[model samples]
Target: MTSAHPTASRQRASAPHAKEHHMRKTVRTSIAAAAAAALLALTACGSSTDSSAPAADGPYTAPAKDITATISVSNWGDPGDKAVYDGVAKRFKEKYPNVTVNNNFTPITTWTEYVNKLVTQAAAGQAPDVINIATEGVELGMSNELFTPLDGFLKNDPEAASLRKDIDPKLLEGFSKDGSTYLMPNTFNTMVIYYNTKMFKAAGIERPSDDWTWDDFLAIAKKLTTGSGANKVYGFAMPYYSFGITPWLYSNGTSMMSADLQTAQLTDPKVKETLGWVRDLVTEHGVSPQPKGADPYQLFPAGKAAMTGAGHFVTGGFAKAGFSDYDILPWPKGTTKSTVFGAGAFAISKTSENPALSWEFIKMLTDQQTQKQWADAGAAVPSTKTAASTPEFLASPKHADEFYNSLSYAKPVAAPRAYNVLDPAFMRAMDEIMSGQDIGSSLEKAEKDVEEALQQ
Candidate 1:
């Protein structure tokens, strides 16, 4: 069932802010862990000159009504997400009375294992009609091999085509292989500072505003980490491999590769500075933790640490814990004002007998009205311009205002499946540097190691 276009597909949401550079960044990774990331980046960068036309060359339209079909979809557990999908499924059933849907859901706590389960189901020809997938999910599944291209349906259905607002170009890049669409975007998260107000007051640091920078962040982290026996708090979190460097890298205007995602070009001075800075956060500054598990939930929510790096997913957990008074501040400005956003999307398996029906259900989950409803309810950030701008999302919720403002300066790296590999490798290199090795030499070796892995 492979598409006529032998080339892989890619989806990206281009924003004005993605064009900006990253600020200070410092990270540590061992060579073994970052290899896959390097390969994924290289694969994504490969052949910017379209290998072929999009897979949507065929003109296919879904049936009008009364089809005896069903779609079983899976996603991370979010009441808001389920509700939106339920609404869409209901609408779909109304529109096509004959369609029956069998929905299979797994809690987010177990989402990391969903791909393995899916692969087994798929290999046994028992894959669902649709699936909710993120970066790890897609690459692990090599979703392009499994999911049918929606460009054909998108070209024919106005309802589907009207989704331009819902789908950001850079996000499309995240799901893309070359330059065509593979997965349909549902929602996205922009990385910003989520600060605890109580902690801020205790630390005697002023509330963060748009004017804050990395230096300001360090000051606040220092203050918040203060205390004596039985009450000592760590300042900032240690640099984690995932989602930690996005704002820093983008703000510093550096990338793991050249513009094309080809050839290891990460040895730039800015990248070195960023990595050194990250290491220093742990060693010299005594601000953040060592780049290990990098779990904010374990640190900040429990009040063992001051500031930590995380996304919208952290908000619900924080509120549930009764850690009142927090805000989403613009990621403290780096060398550049650019920001990094993480996201997820939905796609239908190509092997399914109900491609058209599956798309109808998937699109329904990500529509404008539904996205806003969910985001407002505190599930995930809406990807659309209109939905995100709403007052509910713009106000309160611990740096919510500043978090929203940072979107104007945001961009996301094309998170390909290889990140699952590259992230660990990148983190390992940092491990070596932290162990007291030469910074430039380690980076140069990492550059070689990362590029070599990509060549594989």
Candidate 2:
């Protein structure tokens, strides 16, 4: 969700070269115009009915299992995601034998592209009944009136209520707008330092603690780096994407926007310092590769770099490459131990013909048993603490718990209603800074760009 690139390991497998960024500038002008028109039309129609408003009169009763219905769901799919979905569907069939869920999965791509495609599809009357929305697209989806509120179901259904209690409230908060819930939080990810144990051992550097600081991390990176040119092994492969770099800014006690999501904070002194610090890792310290086109997910496991910033999803790639000598650590502290996190959700489309059936399916997706299966797959941290703490999840890479533990100090990735505009503006500034432009000037431009876009 923090990434425009699919966060699921399954989606990543099909698009290994895809940039792991948030929203990028991939929306076609025609489709973007349609999206704007759709939002404006919905707003003009006073479409914010009680279904999407705060009022929940009573429980939403799901239809009988014997009732037959076929509903299509949209998602980013690859072989792995297909397998998981098939498995879940099989189990879901045992209970609702007559209900059918047709998954419409698109290949992994930039979030802007996906959103534009959805806008085009909806215009053609081919939108799916349900959508697997990540944080990056949540606000856009909401602003476009793409989802129906689930407060009635969540507050009234016994099973859904149980799920609400089991999931972390913070994650629930991410999927909520105003006082209505539009989606159920499923799997999530948070940033952490993934280091190669063998490389650390070779450098004679002990593993950093959960409380390690920025200076300590820099020192270790310097020690681990060696050689030069083509044969050089960078100590770290700095991720240049929004999801990858946000943790650094977050750790430094700054972010791209204000908490209210109404203003840009990119020009904050702390933000400038953080960007400069990351730039120096490549330009001055020479411990990390240039962030412009870095691929830490591949570089870290290929043994080309000793460390990288990533989430649990990278573990799948590492396992496929037969690289297992790595462990995770909390992001090093700056003024605090803060880090960025993101979650995906199962959102029922406002245009769905069978809202009750969609609610039942969403409940199935959020079940603890389903979450445990997802945790065992090792892609993301399950939103439910019970599922995330499973032995199966903790079996690999010592300190796997750090992924879940970081939630204590982590903030949801910055995804405001204007994300489509905000993400690209911020990313452009980051790219300029990484390419050696002046940080202060770049951020000033980014701030101006973002604020102006928001006002429009």
Candidate 3:
């Protein structure tokens, strides 16, 4: 939820492009939520034009005096990235003093547009030596043959092996194509139920009791929900975007898409019934607010509202803003206790001047020590079980238990062949549904739109 989601494709929406409507907070995918959306699936295409040129692997023995070349690392630079990337470049510099990394950080101001510019750069033979690719950029870069596979170097190294083992493999699943590996794992933020304890005090609702049900949640939500017009404070906002809402339907065992990815299973009456509660929270019960105007991240942290949907990445933002008095709990259960799981990794360029050097960088990026730095800083939830359970984090970290507990019910985002095209329209559909439109009707439209897009 803290990642950036890309905002554009080669084919821009005829309407003025929008980055967040019903969308959850992403600095905008991996690099922002758009990048994550694109990363949801994998691609095999390598760089074209000078594509046949063999990989320039290197021994990369550290020069007696480390030569300094600023590594042009690209990332979908969002607020989350700024928080997470802290000391990463510093750590890399500490490890290799001569290596200067100047980040070409992609602004999540509007991620889709940002991604298209990135792909154009990649396709035009101008991608930076190191880039932060997520679901969005991966498809564009891989299909157009921009990224060089990291498989060869990583498979043979020991430090790199340890780093890989230290991180979660779910990230690999998010960034793989066919049978090949493309990215190295980085930080991950999963979806969790963000609640306002102050609201609990107001409503006399006990802090989320273990083993609460969806019905139990709704009952409490109604009590805390209040206001009318712009003054409204929603008890909860069913993640208005598909990334937040889809899993709920899926966890309740309602398929969002058909097996062939051709039809909208949410078109079923039962499916509509399931989502109806989410809508009713706003329209029927007046317990929730309609999603609007960027994301409410600052609001929750600022204590403007009671409950909002969020995950680990937002923890720092909350603390910095002084809304540190919060607790994370399971997303209330329906038929089952399901929550969305997400992860990230790093990738070395195949055409790098020093593949070995790149491998070393990858190792440093994924190393447990480095991972611990990021996690302890409150940038994100670490991928390793060991990191998550560490005393330094658990004994002091806020929302510690809720963040780890959600993993038991975590489900990775569903990405088909190419994921970049899948997210925008899906967001649009979710927006429509949350606006009190028919869930069945909107999902059907989404299916048609997605099918047409994938074929393109």
- Most lDDT-accurate candidate: 2
- Predicted structure 3: lDDT: 0.56
- Candidate 3 C-alpha lDDT tens digits along 1-456: 333121110011100222332232433332343453332222222232232112335432333336665455656444545655655777778767887776656554566666565555555554455656544344444544445676655565444566667555655665666666777756666666778776777678777765678888887777776776767776775545555665567557665555434444546665677777677776788776666563446455545566766556555555555555667777777888776655555665544454445555666666677667656766466666667778876753355766656656665555443344456566677688777687877877877776775576
RMSD (Cα, Å) for all candidates, in order, is 8.8, 3.9, 6.3
Model 1 local distance difference test score: 0.56
lDDT values for all models: 0.56, 0.71, 0.56
How far in Å is the alpha carbon of 439 misplaced in model 3?
A: 3.2
The top-ranked prediction according to TM-score is 2
Assess the local accuracy of residue 332 in candidate 3 as a C-alpha lDDT between 0 and 100. Answer: 72
Rate residue 315 of model 3 by lDDT.
59
Question: Each candidate's TM vs. the true structure?
Answer: 0.74, 0.86, 0.76
Residue 143 displacement in candidate 1 (angstroms)? 9.8
Ten-residue segment with the worst summed lDDT in candidate 3? Answer: 6-15
